[model samples]
Target chain A: MEFYQRDRTLQPAGYTPIYKTSVARSPRQAMLSLQGSLSETTGPVFGQNELGPLDNDLIRNYAKDGDPIGERIIVHGRVLDENNRPVPHTLVEFWQANAGGRYRHKKDTYLAPIDPNFGGCGRALTDENGYYFFRTIKPGPYPWRNYVNSWRPAHIHFSVFGSGFAQRLITQMYFEGDPLIKECPIVHVIPDEDAINRLIAPIDLNGSIPLDTIAYKFDIVLRGRRSTLFENRLEGN
Target chain B: MVQSLDYLKETASQTAGPYVHIGLIPKQAGFDIFENNFTNIMADENTRGERIIIEGRVIDGTGTPLRDALLEIWQANSDGRYNHELDRQKQGQIDERFRGWGRAGTDFDTAVYRFETIKPGVVSGRNGLDMAPHINFWIVARGINIGLNTRMYFADEQEANATDPVLNLIEQTERRKTLIANRDDSGPVPVYRFDIVLQGENETVFFDV
Candidate 1:
C-alpha cells in the first residue's frame, strides 16, 4: 500500500493567528522541518472482524431498560478521505450531553439533572462505503466557565481512526442553527469561519425515523483540500 | 517556477473536550456498554518480556494536571515484531497473546494515567537501521485541539536512546529529556515515570505527523 500523503494547507495552523494563546504552546520550530517518518507508518492496525455487533446506540445502554429521556434524534454521515474516497472499517466514536444539558461525568458539576436512561456514548465502524449511523438524543447547550457565563452549543464529540495514528482525528459536531455557536470560545478558536461552519450538521428529515426521531446529517472530510491560487500567479498580470 | 494545479488541504482539528472518556471508556463513565474497556491491560501473564509499569501525568503550560486527558500507546512486541499483518509476515512469528497496544485515561482525582506492559524490543526502521525501543503516545485533553504525538524512550537504555534516529533529530538537546522516562526500580515491578508536559519550559517534543 502507498503512503497516505496529507495536504498541509487545509490543516489548521498550530498557532492560530486569531487564537493568539495557541502560539505559546503549539510547536513552531518542529512543524517547519519534521515530516512523517517510518515511525508514523508503524502504528495501530484495527480490523472490522475483531469488532462485534454490540451496543451502538447512544440513547440507551442494555442495563437501562427504557429509552433515554430526550429529544430523540438520529445522526448519520459518511467518513471520507481528502480525495473523497470512503474510509472503511474505521472506528467512529461519539459522546455528548443528555438532552437536559448534563453529562454523566464526575467533574461536570453542572446542576442539570442526569437522565437515568441516557449514557450519551456510542461507537460504530464505518461500513465499506464509509457511512456511519447512530441513534442519539439531541444534546442541549450547557454553561461553562470560559468567561463569566459561557454556554457551549449543543454538540457531539467525534473521534475517527484512520489506518495509522497520524490520520486519527478528534473533533466536535454542532447543530446547524445553534444560536450559542457564535458565543462559544471553543468554536471561535478556529480562525476560519468557513471551516467552523463545516462542523455544523444540517437537518435531514428524510433520514429521521418518522414519529420517533428527527435526523441530522454530517459528513466528515478527513485530510482533504481545496484549490487555492498562489500569489505569484496573478491572472490579471 | 511553475505553479501546481491542485494542492490537497488537511481537515481542521478540535479539542477532544472533557467528555472524551465518556465515549471511549463508557464503563469508566458509569456505563457498562462494553465487556472490556478500551484501556484495559495490554499484555497478560503469558506474554513475553520483562513486565513494566508506565505511570505519568499530562500537565499543561501552568504545570496544572489535566484530569480529562486520554492517552493511547502503540508499540512493537517483545521480539520487536508488531501484531500487524505486514510485520508478522515479514518477521515470521509474533507472540499471539501480545496485543502491542494499550490505552489509559488520567484518573479524575489523581490526574495520573498508568499502563502495564512489557518492554518493546528494538525494531528495524524504514532504512533498516535498528530503531530505539520506544512507545508511541497519542494524547487528547480539554485544551488540546489536535491530539499530540510523542514517544517515550527508556531512560535506562542510554546506548539505544543515543542512537535513536528520531531522538537525534531533536535540534534542542534539552527538550529530548521530556521524551525519556525515568526508571523507578523501587516498585515490585519496574516502573517508568514519563510525565508529558503540553507547554511551558519542559514541553514534550511533539511530532508534526
Candidate 2:
C-alpha cells in the first residue's frame, strides 16, 4: 500500500531559532539538503500474535491490587494513515504524570507527592479498525525547568509506530480548553494554529461510562504528503 | 484570519523526555513490569550469518553522554532479506527466529548502548543498485524533539561501501565515515564500534525521514 509521503513543511524545522537547544545541533543547510535523498529502508513487521492482551491497560501494573489513585478515565481513538485509512496492529505507547502532577520518574523534581498506585505508563495496539483505547487516569499539569515558573499543561505523551520507519511520530496530546496551551513553548513550535488545535483531544461524553469513568477521544493522523497545493492560484477559471 | 484551504497539517513533535524509559522498558527503569526488555535481542542462536556486536555511546553537543537516549534498530537478516511480509515475498524463505528488530536504552551509568546480531547482507537499493549492509537506527532523547534517523554501515566491507548508493550520495567524503562502524576483531566476538554524536564537528549524519 502506498503510504503518505514525507512533508517537509508540515514538520518542525530542526534548527528552529526559537527553541534554544535546536540551535546547537539542529542540521544546517548541508544536512537539511541531504535528507531529501534518504529513502525509506526496512519497515517493522509486527502483528497481533506478537502482542499480549494485558499490554493495553495502564492500570494493569496494579491489577492484582485496587485501582490507581486518580480520576478514572478512558482515552480512546483511531490511528489513521494520511490517506484516512485505519492502521491496524500498530503500537501506541503513552506516558504521563499522575493526577497530583508528579511523575514516577527519578529526574522529575516536581514537589507533588507520587501516587504509589499509579505507574503512569501504558501501551495498546490498534485493532483492525485502527482503534485503540487506554484505561488511564486524568494526569495533572506539572512544572518544568524550560523557563522560570514554567508549568507544562496537563498532557500525555504519545508515541505511534506506523508500517514504516519513516511513519514513526512522537507527540503530546493536551486536554481541550486548557489555558496553559497558549503559553506552552513546545506546542507553539508547530507554527500552525490549526495543527496545534489538532493535538487537543475533546471530551467524549459518549465514550464515558457514567459514574465509573470519563472518556477522552484522541484520533492520530499519520503523515501522508500526497496533497501539495501551491500558493497564489490563478483566479477561478 | 487567512485559511489555506488545503490538507490538514501534520502534528507537532516533542521530546521523549526522562519518562520514556519508564514507560517503554519498565524493567530497565526499575518498574519491573516485564520479565525481560521489550527488545533485548534481534536474532537468536539459530539465526544465520556471522554474529557481531554493535556498541556505542550517544554524545550530545556539550560532549556529555546522553544517559536518557533510547535507541531502536531495524535491519535485514543475514540473507539480505527482512522478516516482513513484503521482503518474504521477494526472498521466499526467512529465518523464523530472527525478529530483525531490537531496542536498547543507554546505560544509566555508562551512557552506552549495545546490540548483538548477525551481519546483514547487501540489499537492493533505489533504482536496482546494490546497497551496503547497514543497520537502520532511530534515536530519541531528552533534548531531541524528533527521533533522529540514521544508518550504520560496516567498515570492513570496503568494496560494498564504495559502491553503496546511499553512501555515495553524501557529497562530502569525510562525513560518510560517520555511518561506517569500525570493526575490532581483537575481542572474542567481532565488535563494530559506531559512536553517535548528536552535534558538533563530528555530528553523525541524521536523515530527515
Pairs of residues at least 3 apart in sequence or in different chains that clash in candidate 1: A10-B9, A82-A224, A224-B9, A225-B9
TM-score of chain A of 1: 0.83
Q: Can you write out model 1's per-residue Cα lDDT over A1-237, one digit (the tens) per residue? A: 223455444445555544443444355445423444434554565555654455467665532678777788889999987677787887888889988899988767899998888777878888899999988888999987656677889999998876556677888999988999998777877767778888999999999888888999988876532233453432110
Residue-level lDDT of model 2, residues A105-163, one tens digit each, is 77677789977777788787898999999988899988776677777889999988877
DockQ of 2: 0.33
TM-score of model number 2: 0.90
Listed models, DockQ each: 0.29, 0.33
> How accurate locally is residue B36 in candidate 1, as Cα lDDT from 0 to 100?
44
Q: Which run of 10 residues does model 2 chain A get worst, by summed lDDT? A: A32-41
Q: What is candidate 1's TM-score against the reference?
A: 0.88
**Against the true structure, what is model 1's DockQ?**
0.29
